[model samples]
Target: MENASPPSILIVGLDRYGMRACVRLGLEITVVCGGRSWDDGQVAVSPEVRVLLVDDHTNPEAVLMALDRAGLTDRAFDAVYTTDENALVMVGILARHLGLPAVPPEVAVRFRDKAVQKREIRAAGLPTAGVRVVDDVHDVTGITELGFERAVLKPIAGAATRRTSVVTSVAELRACSAAYRAEGTAQRTFVLEEFINGEEWFADGVLFDGELLFCSLSRYGDPCLTAVDTARPLHYRLFDPVTEAWAYDRALPLVTAALEALGHRDGTFHMELFHDPATGALTFGECGARRGGGLTQELVHTKFNVDLAECAILVALGRRPQLDIKLRPEAVGGSHLLAGPGLLYDCPSATDVLALPGVEFVRMEWPVGGRTPQGGGTAQRVGQFMVVADSGERLQERFTAVWDWFDARVKVVPDGLKTRELRELQHVLRPEARFGDALWQ
Candidate 1:
């Protein structure tokens, strides 16, 4: 048979660092974007990357159809990289069907579905926060009977904290259920768990046939999902790895246990965990077999010289990636999602900020006249700024200066506001915690 066209990597999402990582790896890439930025064919990037404009409303089957039309599904590509936690299963199944490896399709659902993952992790005697899945609104009452002070209500298989809520009272729990029902969501899977209040950390690592190849811990002063306000255009400083430990001793064991329990034989593992400072309690939150969102992969690369997207691609292609994790002391990196009024306005001095010593990238999502809705998804970003510094404190200083500068520079000119009340509610509900200040000046 004639030799197939040069091996290509098909990346299914265009959110954060995945596309860049694939490109940096020098892999022939075809990016399938379901968002307008990808659909309008105005994505400003290298020409080597082929863009497949797909609609946001396109179903999973439709995505596969697009791939087939591109002749990619006919064994033209060597591997596929898919983001979006909930799409893990479908992407894996599709990739496998096309005769390619996809980070072990058997455990794809475990990453997105909390109930299934919790059960399997518990079965393996791994330390995991307690979870109760509710099939109906009435299940909230039973969940309350478990005697937990607070319960986290989240969709079983979803991302970006779409319906994730922390309920302290039975009323709030019932309200969460009502809200879910009001949306008419067919899959009413809800995970009610004991809230783990502590220092939050994220562990992203690669696994080769059940063996850990690389792992690093990302420390957060607050729970990541709770750190942002969806009621307003919100932005926050990214976590710096300077204070974080490269050797996640506690996490290493827990990860191994979780993987063994979930039967995840291959692929990258993105895990969120909580460590109680008072008691040194370590608990598993969730794990995904795919790359994480929030531009985390890029943060890791800039801080530690590790590329998770590249790792995912290499694993998918069955090629062992080089392992040279260069650790640097006092090195820091982070990104800020610029959120504000739904409508975009004149953004200030981004060029000047980009010129800063440690600054790496400045990306604005919405155009000067684009509308930015109050949201927690990737679309909510008005802009994003990334920077690196000598320490976490320096990083935060630069981040805050630039953020305040951006906020002052940008304002919605015409006000037909939609999320005004929601913004006020968030200020009331949101607590004041100094994120990224632990290692600050």
Candidate 2:
């Protein structure tokens, strides 16, 4: 349907990359966002585009009313899509009502609920940890009967590993459950799964029309649950196809099957998994129904020369994406620079990080004085950056060099800062700054 006016698509949530990619693809777009989400300015939405805010984007009637209010109710829409998990079901609902191209609502629900997602994986004869769901508002002691010595605990919806934990005893389970309940928030439901002793890895893929088009696997520096609390920064290195061909051969099938098991026919998927170092077996962890967050799609480009953002928009518009994994010339890796379980007082500028050799990209996650909470889990970060190298050894060195460089300038106060330090910690938190020194470092 090539025409003077671009084919319009309705996005149910804010996704910066998807919006820009749509512009690149020459598509007309309308966006509907929940009032809280729209106002949060997370997307930093542009006023030039058509956007509608409603009390609830999940309510198709409200969305229609917003469209009516904006005089866009009768506009031709080619697809309904969203990168926000909270909006997937809404997008699916709108897609079904409008007969537009998108993943089915049932499939969307499967991704939203971890219990259903794991059940679907198990049903497909895939290996995933055995899980039991318990409400945080009740006595979670009953899960002890499952007889698993070690278990994993997380919100039923996988809330970015905010409170995810590995429990070795019932006491720990009760403590985590109590913490979640005490929060008095929507994440009162939790899942307990048998913990698998294996290396954690991430799988990113683009699937369209039930056919897998592109997939990439990367090895995490440590188990996700453990790394959130450690001072060590979380890192991941992409599997080089030349030396790690087995990773592709093994994980590609699992990713494809997992998507198929959940009836996720179209769009991109970001999945977590565990791989046994000894046996090479894979355990499905969790999957998200959109592109991986935080430069993942861009990292995909650095490793494979493929743009997942463009592919997602292509399928969203009911168009074919030229999906191909073209090998790059060097090793690629990414890191989330950890700053605190306390106050993050300072960090080097983006330019400071980019000045380091082999640093391809960097973004400071926290501004000066943005505090990271005690036990913030994986959400703790000062920034994220990517680096490239001609060899794997060089890549490791680059990562080490970046960390070493940051250690010199970045500042965090594990113990509460003094009144003056709270006012300014660059002097106190710096590496060379001394407690009783007469001059500031």
Candidate 3:
């Protein structure tokens, strides 16, 4: 007897990690990237894998034509998956067009639209923040009618906190809206939701057959908005027994309820929620139908031994994912090295970061001389690294020690202070308002 040929998968976007997962599963892969070269030399796949270049990865028609030109239209495919948010709807449409297994296109749209998602959750009787869809900054007046002291303004379909801001006063609201308009994004519908003040956390896991199979809750060291507003280093750790127990008791049920209501029957989900330290109440933030960003998938693997990337592909292929949901004794976390407003002159070597105690891996995105933009958004972060330890306390200790070492070694020369003369100009002016409240205002 001979082995059957591996199932073929068409991944609609450039997800190097997802591609690696397909290769690991021994599946034949066809990657369609959106007008970008696949130069990420991360993982090598079988020679059987194919790459199709397309002008627009988010256009289902364009993708289908490309697939047809690549001789894929006549072939049987097990699944169509995309890690890119913009490509989710495209994947869903492609799945239906190709008769592959996937969540419906409408469901994918629900995942992409924050206003729609909040409405669905509210309709399901699940707890969610009050959200108003505004066409422009001036429309935020409706949010004031909702009688909330503060609100969060963000694009209905945006990610990574891009164009996201917190507005307390009407003036701030208008200013934030003006900035978005200046960037030519004002015409797009945005959501202004009642701000939930509390500790921010996220739950990432796989759902199988309408049941939550595996979920890990992570606590952010600082609020995501704060991290973006201040250029502060971002840190998050997967729960150990104590924190896990707390989340399971307080937050997991809410997350499960929201997913059940959203018709998220199968696939990976990354959900953000808040826990009120004052009242112990849990409120829904937002969620996506994909793995969490940054080192989230890595933390899950390091802590629970579940490879979410691989499981995502398997679930998309209509196979029951085999995951180790049992929590491990060890703890895992990651810290992103955020670059301040400047010309990034130097940073500690990956080798040096890797040599730190309990360090698992280091991924540096900024080469020396790269310009670090003048903002606190996640896009401005220079690099990140993950660490694992035997216990939660040990993990925190290592994070502190490693970051202290990093702060001492990493250097960023202010954007204008490239020479001694420019450096003198800094002292002659009021301190530049590069980030934080000043930038947002």
Candidate 4:
């Protein structure tokens, strides 16, 4: 075993974090990716790693052709995996092709395909909101059949809430869908789901062999569908197991059950659920069969000493994480300052942000002369920072102070509304989160 070559993997798409994990594990990595992902994520591949550039990593045919060209069809891969959400189905197919250790291709599609996921969850008798597929995202003539006054519309397999929106009226939906089509999203499949009003929270952890290895819960500041398009900074905080037992008691079962329903095993999971304080019910939003996005790895590591990226790779290679989490007494949280539209300037420096109380890390892309797209999603961030505190109360206070610390220094032009607030107000001002095209930036 000492002289054995490191476990080899065939990756469908190259993610910066995934690549880093592969290096740490000393795996022989072969990645099939499209051209734009290289520059988009600023991913740097080492010479030791094999890179196979294809026209589309998400396309099974293109990936197969790339493999055939590289003469890797018969290659004995230890596993087939992908951290990129877009290429998950393709990875599943490749996993089955190589008879590698990973979820079946059909099960893998459940993580990305909302319709199939919801159906499976429903069949499992889990509480899920009603969903109807919109064969054409641009047309919603049969909206009445959905039997809901308000609904959430998003791509079938989309991530980061790109082009996701809320529709309350037919006119508004038509206009929004028209806008989506006009922006070249006509070919994408979308779905409409009955909107569940409640405080939205998410759980992330590793599950192995149908057993929950570890779990962490966190509550979101606003309905992501509405907050992501506004000036409010999207934020959330991890619930301390000792301090916030209520969240753990309610969320743990749901996360595990839902992951099981989707047939997910031996991997890190990111599941979003809605907690109805009024009714004491949890509704499934969605789940991803990978590590949570953003600085989650850092946040989890800072508080619990768990490396989710490392765990993800280990699980893919059919190995146990054997996770030993040394939970710190302190709590961890993160805030993302998002833009609306127009130009952004005078963003705060990481050094200045680091000076703030409890601030542990900062990652921002908002430069002085950068421009933001119209429909600003999660990706449209001025930047984000992580904070740690001894308790949840102190964490909340620091979360607010971080906002005030940044707002005073940053400035935006053309429309000050784009990124001016730099703080969360929806929770305080509007207890009930509502979404419509009017709120869409």
Candidate 5:
């Protein structure tokens, strides 16, 4: 008799990255995505890959019903995969309903809600900043009672630092909270946490069967909060495994402890943390049950030669991930391109940027004449690029060179019809003077 067909997999979102994962897994894949058109050329249309269009992929029940209607309910799927943050909780719920291996809905909720995450970490005896969940603007003053002179206020389920702010006084807290509420952009619940003053870093890796398989620690050019506050472009440099012994010695154990506390299992995790230089204390910042954003995955591949997307897909299939955690000699880094508030008339061509020495790739978002949003959060970014070099210094030099070239070459027409030098454009970069704040810097 012919062998039974390979176990079918259901992918909740059909983004380019997810599509690539499906292809890598080489499974009979079914995709449930919102919208009518699949115009993006990233995902190839094939008999092996079926697409089920839905109005909303965030509704788990709707997605499951769509799966049934699409004739995938006759048998159980081997796995369900999704990388879209909006669909993560939905994927977890659907996986539970299907009796598949996935992050538990309760755990997923903690990942989505910062307040819940901090509470869980604290309860697990891990070091986390003091936090309070407030439902109204009036409740924000409680931070002072918690003995915090400065605190961070953000939506419970926000991403990329959207609507996040650092408030040093009761008035700033009240104003920030009130603005969010009045703007109708804030979630029903917001988290207020004592701001940990220190250097910020991120740990990205995969967990297989509750065991940490691979992890890479990266240092950000500036605190992410500062990036949002200053509307500056953000960058991160992956530590050279051979040279950055201190990071591994200091940060990795904390990351492992965090994962253990969070009950992480069978998925990629992106964790952010802070290291206080004065006190030598490592504090948890936040984490997500997915790969790090921007060029993180790419950096992982470039440095460690692992495919996080493929590994995540493998975990979903209940198979062991093929990961080798040896760091390469080269270093990898990337930065976002932010456009000033204006009608974008022109920018350095991706082709030209690609021609720069050590530059690897560039992805542009806004076209000519597109109105650039006032830059602050990650969402306002126009594009981003990644590079690889022999060492961190070389990487920084190349990156700065590319930035200078772009600043001189690109032109933006200001919204008020004013002419401003593109060099005078307020794209965020960490000030060089503050470079000494952290050892890695």
Candidate 6:
């Protein structure tokens, strides 16, 4: 933890999950906060770790300009990284200009955009949800012929499911146009796709020069795309060794094919997927070519005894990271997003929950004086608490119990000192038939 040999690293998108992973490795990290009030999160950097806060409202060009002014450009940092899927291209362009081997900008674009993912998956003969690119409202009528009861619509350059919607009827066709227009389609791009009902999973791993190094698979307690409400709290249990063994034998190769198809040759990747139990079909959703967001970066290290962020830093610095993960370890862990039935009144007993036995860490997202978001993305997550145990199911129970305790204690308030109770709540809610964007009009 000493700064004597801190590895110099540059991280774009201060809120990206990569920070946690790198922190565990004891690297000297410099982050570009971007100065946007909303996108910025409370990132704890060591005194030895440098930070460069960008202008409150600067574009990509300004980001680079700020780095230069802050004297960071003169520093010998390992590599530049970002968790902003939308900024992959920009990150690449910036890093490459500095002669660093950033994540491929072209690959970054292809992975984050659903439209691009669908076409690439199909061309590679990999299984994936049926997707169609929508240029405008005229394309909305075609959904009626498809007759799919549910479909999902999402922005091409979105993260945290911004402006994502699911529709179940022809009458909801207007949502497509409205969603697209809201995204400014004249310049932005989006997609409509058949909503598949199934168990959702996220596979996290590091790829050094296109070779899979260390990886883990985890199951989502609720389907992110189909949940009754996007803000509902959820957890992910690391796939047991038996289950992961199956995936490594059966699914890993397919994933590699997917990586190769996207033209990604290096860096970390967090891929989201859906697997139908009935049909056993693996549908590739999308991927982020950087370290994953949410609690993944931290949980993986706690459970697997490996430092992902350190490896990323070493890779960025053009060094071979020491790989230290055993496929079989005596640990089970999961994370819970703090979701409220109504507007978040307050997260009480949060400290108590963190004090629970087996609880490892609790990271809260709420601002001391800020009101909670009504719905969508990281906004709804007031906090994320993690638990580790001897088995996956046990870990799930510990984490869920914490969420239950918070649900009962937290309240949403409208006025000073006035408190209101939350609505009916469930430990876990899954969205199945509901489509984010309706396939049939």
Candidate 4 wrongly placed segments (more than 4 Å): 1-3, 46-48, 142-146, 343-346, 366-370, 411-441
Q: In candidate 6, where is summed lDDT lowest over 10 consecutive residues?
A: 421-430
For every model shown, what is its TM-score relative to the native structure? 0.81, 0.89, 0.88, 0.87, 0.87, 0.81
Task: Give candidate 1 regions above 4 Å deviation.
Answer: 1-4, 15-28, 35-37, 40-46, 49-51, 55-60, 68-73, 136-147, 180-187, 229-247, 377-379, 413-441
Judged by whole-model lDDT over C-alpha atoms, candidate 3 comes out at 0.79
lDDT of 4 by residue, 393-438 (tens): 7888998898887776565554554333423432332447853336
Which is the winner by TM-score between candidate 3 and candidate 6? 3
Model 3 CA lDDT for position 414: 72
Of 1 and 4, the candidate ranking higher by lDDT: 4
* Candidate 2 TM-score versus the reference: 0.89
Model 6 Cα lDDT, one tens digit per residue, 185-274: 553455667887788877888778778887778778788754436455666767755645775555577678888888877777888888
- Residue-level lDDT tens digits of model 1 in 367-431: 66676555354345665666676766776677667666666556554456357754544433343
The digit string of per-residue lDDT tens for model 3 on 288-404 reads 998888988778887788888888888898888877565667788998876566667778888889998999988887667768754345656777899888877888888888878
- lDDT (Cα, 0-100) at 239 in candidate 5: 82
lDDT (Cα) of model 5: 0.79
Which pairs clash in the backbone of model 5?
A: 232-428, 233-428
Evaluate all candidate structures by whole-model CA lDDT and list the values in order: 0.67, 0.79, 0.79, 0.80, 0.79, 0.68
TM-score of 3: 0.88
Clashes of each: 4, 0, 0, 0, 2, 16
- Higher-scoring candidate on TM-score, 3 or 4: 3
- Number of the top-ranking candidate, with TM-score as the measure: 2
Residues 312-405, model 5: lDDT tens digits? 8888888888767666788889888877787777787788889989988788756777788552567677778898898788888887887778
